[model samples]
Structures are given as structure tokens and as C-alpha cells.
Target: MNTKQMIKENNRLQDAMKPDNLSYYQDMVVYIRSSSVEESKGEELLLEIAQHLLDAQAKGKTAEEVFGSDPESYCKELVEQLPKMKGLNRLQYHLMIPWIALTWFFFVQALVGFITTWTGGPVERMTQVRISTLVLIAGGSYVLIHALMRWMKNDTFQPDEARRKINVRSMGIYMAITVLILIAGVWLGRLLPVLTIAPWVSLVLFLVGIAGTKFLFSSK
Candidate 1:
């Protein structure tokens, strides 16, 4: 199928599935990509898995039965079976790691800062930290947005203008969210007290949150 056709089919499949099932499939796709599978192959794998789910549902089976009780393990097995790509695809796959990490790092810091603010942490110290954190957040946001655009442009699976536009729009939404969070953090830092926890403890908490969120979203 052509790129537009493929995207249409993908959208149809996603719309047909239950929300939880769609989320499961989306998570699986993310996991597969993060596992170093090439983008085209990842999309092919997702389409195959999505079809299986639809067929199972038609047979009156739950998504759990279709995907198995342990979706994470199933996805890992799929990743293991994928043939490694060479050349630019391989390079792009490796590059995605640090890009994703930087994005997650900023996201975690923003979330943690918001938590600290809501808890009545001291405003003075937080305001001081916010300066540096904001700078890093802006840089991280730019890196993430740029990486996403580059990925979309280079993706072999969705080379059509339609798919590229869709992907860019999604990235724009994510950027908007990042901007809002940064703004909120700045305002909150000015209003709240400094956190009672030590810097190390807070750092630990941020790491934990980043790890958990990454696992859930990327599963890598």
C-alpha cells in the first residue's frame, strides 16, 4: 500500500479498537521502536499485531488473549525476532536513545518541580534552581522537537506529505505541552517554598519518575 493508504488503514485500526487496546498497541509500537527496530519494520509489526487483535476480537476474544497475558514480554520477543537494519536506519535507531533520554529528563524535572511547589516547598531555593532548570528544559525541548521532526522526515514507513504533516502536528502538541509546563514551573517557583527534601533525595525521586514513565511509554 502507499503511504497515505497505510496511514488511513492505521487510523482505521486505531479507531476500531477499544481505548485500552489501542493504548496497548501504541505502547507496543513504542517499545518495538525503542528496541532498535527500524521504523518501517516497526510499523509493519504494529499493523500485523493490530490485525491479530482485530481478528481475535471478531472471534470474541479479549485483547489480553490476543496479545497474551504479558504484553511486555510479547513485545520483547517480537523485538528479538526483528532482523537488524544497517546504514542510516541503524544510525537513526541509535540516535533516538539520547534524544528520548533528554526529553524524559526534562519532563521528570518539570513534574518534580511542580510537585515540590504544590507541597509548599521554599520559594527562594526553588527560584534559584528554576533558572538553571529552565535553561536545560528549553534546550531539551528544542532537541526533542528537532529530533522528532528529523525522525519523521527520515522515516521510511511514512514518507508521504500527509503522514509527515500528521507527525509534525503531534510534535507541535507535545511542544505546546512542554512550553506550558515550563511556564507553570516558573510561576510556581516564584510562589512556593523550597522543598524539605535534600537535593540528592529530590534527584533520586526525579530519576525514579523518569524511569517509570519511560518504561510505561517506551518500555525500553
Candidate 2:
């Protein structure tokens, strides 16, 4: 199928994404020379790709062999050989991913902080001994989680125009409550090294919160 067809296919996929995530994918499609339709070309184009896949399958080609085992590895290989340009290029953009990831790290940490304060706690631990440890562990864990999440997103392999992105949805009360709990968990997790949020106190709170969360989420 043509690029127009591919982008339409992509937009349908984007609808499932969070707004920012949808915008990112839409921009990716536009940047990649695939954006060409207001309405989706997803179904038609997907049919074409599917037909091709079917043909390949009939010939016993492995999915990995057909789709490529890893686009990231392929992208890396391309960058290795792609000449250093006078100005920015795709390779340079790939480097920006690390910074983008760092941005996400800080953003998530900030979110955790917000989650804590909103749920009646602080994101940063109350003491210095935990401070460096929090920074190191949270920073490292952030990177690992970010990579894992991104990989999962990539593996979903929806086109840049995918229509149904996840994020910023109005699960409303339940999500709010869960995020509150998450914020508290994150805050307490920060204190794990120091054995803070003492067992007796936490045990009672945990049971109560668990009951609350279950009830809220189960609510219509």
C-alpha cells in the first residue's frame, strides 16, 4: 500500500494512545513521510500487509525473518554506517532518545512526588541518608522501567497513526484513588532502605487502603 494508506492505518492505531503519545506517533508518521490522509488508510493498508504476511506464512517464513527481529537493532546498524552530517540527522535524533528518556525519568519522579503530596506524603524522603539512595535507585529503576515500557510499546507495533492510544483517560475516581495509593507506595518505597513507614503503622494502613482501593475500583 501507499504511504497515505499506511498513515491512515497509523491514525486508527493512534486513537488508542494518550494524547501526547498519539501526537508523538502522528508526528513520527509525518516525519517519516507517511502522513497523507485525513481519514484512515489503516484498514486497507493493513489488509495489504496482512496479505503479504499471509503469503510469507504460506511459504513458511518466520515472523521475525519477515518483520525483522528488531527494528531498534536495525536502526542502530543504520546509524553506525550513516555518515555524520553537517547538521542534525536521524542518528542525532537517536541520541536525543537518551535525553528524552532522562526527561521521562525526571518527569516520572516529579509525578511520584506529586502523587505523594496529593495523597498526603512527600516524594523525596525526609532524610539525607535516603536522599542519595533514592536518587540512585529511582534514577536507575526509572531507566529500566522506561526502557521496558518503550519496548513494550514498540512491540505492540502499531503504526504511527494508530487511533486508540492509552493515557490521560478519565477513569476518574478509581484512577485518582489508585494514583494516590501509588504515590504513597512510591514514597514508602523510597524509605525501604531505612525501614521507614514502620510495620505496625503500615500494616494497618495497607489493609485499609487495600480495602478502599478494591471498593473504589470495583465501583461502577
Local accuracy of candidate 2 as per-residue lDDT tens digits, 17-135: 44543443333333222212212232343334345444665686644555475534543343344234333333332333343343344444445545665787743462113333344
Root mean square deviation (Cα) for candidate 2: 17.2
Model 2 lowest lDDT segment of ten: 31-40
Indicate which candidate wins on TM-score.
1
Error of 2 at 114 (Å): 0.9
Could you give candidate 1's per-residue lDDT for residues 17-49 as a string of tens digits? Answer: 877677667766656655556556666777788
Q: TM-scores for all candidates?
A: 0.43, 0.24
TM-score of 1: 0.43
Best by lDDT: 1
Residue 34 displacement (Å), model 2? 18
Please list the residue runs of candidate 1 whose C-alpha ends up more than 4 Å from where it truly belongs after superposition.
Answer: 2-5, 92-220
Local error of candidate 1 at 87, Å? 1.6
